[model samples]
Target chain A: MDPVFMGQVLVRLLPPLGLTMLVSLTALAIATPLGLALGALRAELSDKHPASRIIDAWVFFVRGTPILIQIFAIYFLLPKLGLQPPLFVMGVGALVLNSAGYQIEIGRAAVQSVPRGQWEAAAALGFDRHATLREFILPQAARRMVGPVMNELSQLIKASSVLSVITLFELHKAAEAISSANLRFSEVIVVEGFLYFVFIFGISLIASALERRLSAAGALAGAGSFAR
Target chain B: MTLLAARGLVKRFGSFTALDGVDLDLNRGERLVICGPSGSGKSTLIRCINRLEEPDAGTVVVEGIPTTDRQALRRKVGMVFQQFNLFPNLTARENIAVAPRKLLGLSRAEADARAEALLARVQLAGHADKLPSGLSGGQQQRVAIARALAMEPVLMLFDEPTSALDPEMIREVLDVMVELGQGGMSMIVVTHEMGFARRAADRIAFMDQGRIVAMAPPQQFFDAPPHPRLVRFLDNILGH
Candidate 1:
């Protein structure tokens, strides 16, 4: 493969890649809050309660199956219900559905990591379980779950590549167009892969750096305070 | 008039009976120390006073409010823990200010000023913005005490305030507590520190199983120890 051809292909691929990242980041913003709320609802709420089982069943259905299939269902099924959500919405919907499944697991683990006594203590202090989870547990849980969430976000960046199959013209789509035009499929794939690598790698660096800073800020002021 | 009252406080955790049938009373400005074996339910009994652990069967009334309304009970009573359950994400100041800001509807500046004063009282003025993670265990516990003080609570609960601290750090934390006691804070302290109990507590209550076996003025409880178990338990803790 010619280096010049590869560079040119990458140039075409960058915009789509950039857009994909934008979409993924936006999707990530929504996924974190929604996923965590759903996750909290599961643990703090009981299966015996009417809503708990329903939430469990939803999580089960989402997690039990594959993302690609869910995307196809959302893309195909919703229009039948007379709602033609935009392509961006579909892409976001796909990303949200897929990421939420993973996030549900992440969120559940984070909520559980909080000691039972914390809630008990809060309850004793006069905060109801609901208020306690909101004010105390969730904030601490969010701090603990940051690394996993970054990992999920990195995965989301990669998973978004799947969207190209639906013809949304994300970074991968640009690569495909360049490939089809140049008749240099191998070079184009390499270019796109590198782009994905850069995007994911850059995000990973930022996330870890932010994590360090947050931990530092959170550490107790003096003497044997453990950083998060 | 009783500030807090628990009647036939029976608490069970699954098959294990943590508290069998404990009953107690507390009054305004009274400092009470609860001491017993690890499973003796002293912690549970005090915890129940604020409805921390709801008794399977029994009624707990705090400041004329049924313990069933935990939120209302909590407004009247504040608890500091051995674990120093300060909010990790929040700064030392934020931890102190949370209940006041949320429960009392104090503005941020008001809460901060109040928190600042409480932190100063605990001798942690310089570390106000620091998170619980950066503070020493003793320091964190002090912050917890400061947090409770932020509520200006009618009654306070200290569940082994010094137990989780280092030996050298114990006195530092206890010093602050002793000061609170002197200031006439109504307190229920669950601790093994007999010396502290003797110095600060107006009354001493000793528990075994789930019941208080002895309750009297510290001088009487320590000197006479009518219950055989308290005599042994006190001997064991002091020995340890």
Candidate 2:
């Protein structure tokens, strides 16, 4: 209700926004390739393969449990086992592990969604398995993956708020601290909410724009006559 | 003179037999048309030659090299599918160009030039930049032919290439194929288009229940089909 007070809270939220960005972006950078690799392996290997089973179990565990428990385990449990990482590392690592789980499914669905004919076409053209995947399969699959990947990214950015529990000075922590000090819970919380909305909404916009561009370029290459 | 030989090919999917004790041969520059009732293994036989479906028991030798030499088979054999199977993301030209550039190691410019020439051959030069979705069924099939031709294989296998086309679109694709046959590209086409079989085939093989019921020159095969099953099949297909 108080515009001036809200303005003050917004300025305070800005500095920690960088840390929030760093944690999420860093997690994404690490998780994207890792998830892609794991997802690709899971998709490529039969369910009977040992590595596939391990990856399936890993994904199952990460997805089934609360992410907060995952963070607590990494932060509190890992150190108890005589291995201590920095607080920031623990927080980012938890986000990386959590996001990568979702990303694995994203990557697998993208790869599997590519038509079987594409693989056969590549093979009939004499492409080895590796070249077939790299040149034909992945290029087509990647277009389909954009929307899911961006959605995962948005979820990751929001999930970074949980890092505040580990005492990392990200945006949510800043909001909490300012609210406690100023005794202005409504004003601070509302500004914090607005900032998160803008950030996540911006990502969604970028995701849609990217989806449009890629689909225009490829135009649902996996969906048309070839799928038959 | 024999470019390909498959002896005693037996392919089974679970308990159902797709190809059973099939034997086939292709002399250099020969055009062979295979027609059969659905599920009679017409598609499966050609697919085996290309190693798309590994035979449960048999051998496929192309140009004296066995199918185990996958690279040689890849280089020496090209296949067109029933679905056209053009890479949807790539333009018509790129679809034709990719195999040559990647497998044959042609530089981009060289590959593009080859694609352009092939597009012209298939009578699709003007539509090079268009995606498969933008093209008609006939145009896409032509592009598919061009894509297979880009490999410059001595042998081409077409697995019902026009089966999925609209009736009007079938002729344009068949024309391109007939032109390829005239150019002496050894081919094994699995199609129900008896018109194409008559015009382009040197030998027509009739199959039923995964075995070739009859094999003869097109004139004799049509006029005097050797097997009772083939007689019933031809009557069923052409009786209307």
Candidate 3:
């Protein structure tokens, strides 16, 4: 492997890093809010007087299928139905749906960690469901969700590698393109792996820091009791 | 006018009756102390005052408002939880300011000023900017009291406010309650601290098995203790 060609492979992988993160983050923006709403709604639905099964089907359909296949069905098969979304949109569309599916579990777990007494307290304070959830329930849930959501974001960063398979010019695709042309595929793959590590590691650090800050807010009282 | 009235109060959870046909009344500026054995519904009684627990059968009327109107009732009443229940993501000042600002439409400056004064009253003036994590157990409970008081509530409810604190931290919180009692705030406290009850409670209610077995002036109730269960409970606790 010539160091100079290795340099070219490194340069080729650069553009894709930015592209991959941009695409993954854009997918994340679309996925998170929808996932949060669905997760909160599902929890309320489950606790309803006579429980509904529609949410069950929604969760089942999403968690049961493969995201890669979901993307393939949307990209390769949807064109036959006269729904001709471009490759990038299909890629992001698939990622957002997949992201929302996993994110829903994370969000629901966070919402559950919020003490039920809080909802009662807020309601007792005259806040209706909409105001109580908005002011108290969701803010607490958002703090709790920070850790798992960050985990999801890191997962998205790694999963963006898959976008290369659909002819998207992501980091991994650039590595593949340069390697196949130069026949120095091993070196390019090594470089690509390093980029993935850097991206994921940076995000992991940010996630932990934010978790520390948010959980510290009311920490003293719970801790203070034990400390005394 | 009665500050609080519980009429035929009964609470049940899946056949386990926590409170059954209990009735009680509280007057303005009165301090009531309640004590009982484990699962005796002392906690449930105060909890119902502010709508923390729903009575399976009964009515709780606080300051002319029905506890059934939970939202409106809560704004007029304040609760200090055994666990503190302060928002962990907010500073002491912010925790105190939240409901007043949101519920009462107080400006941030007005709420902050009120919270600061309340914190001072609880001897926690220096701790306003700190998080609950940075405060000691006594300090956190003090902040909880300040948070409750910031609402300018017509009545306050304390559910074992110092139970979660260490022994050394108990006196600090008890002293604050005593001061609040002297200042004419109506309050109901659920506690095992007989000393606090004697010093602060105008009336004492002893509960056993989902009923208020006795209610009287503090001295008479603590001295004579009209029922056998009260006698046994006091003997076991005070004897030790």
Candidate number of the best DockQ: 2
- Model 3 lDDT, residue A129, Cα: 74
Q: What DockQ would candidate 3 receive versus the native complex?
A: 0.36
Q: After superposition, how far is residue B20 of candidate 1 from its true place, in Å?
A: 1.8
Report the CAPRI category for model 2. Answer: medium
Q: Model 3: per-residue lDDT, tens digit, B9-120?
A: 8998788899988898999999999999989999888877776777888888887776467778877887887888666656788778877888888888998899899888
DockQ values for all predictions? Answer: 0.39, 0.51, 0.36
List pairs with backbone clashes in candidate 2: none
Q: How would the candidate models be sorted by lDDT, starting from the highest?
A: 2, 1, 3
Winner of 1 and 3 under TM-score: 3
> Which model is ahead, 2 or 3, in terms of lDDT?
2
The lDDT per prediction is 0.82, 0.88, 0.81
- What is the C-alpha lDDT profile of model 1 across B1-240, one tens digit per residue? 678777887899999898898778888889998888899897787777777777888887777676557688787788888888777777888778777877788888898999999999999989997877789999999998988888788989999889888999999899999999899888899998889999999998888877778888988998888898888877876766
When 2 and 3 are scored with TM-score, the better candidate is 2
Model 3 CA lDDT for position A133: 72
Which lDDT value does model 3 have at A126? 56
TM-score of 2: 0.95
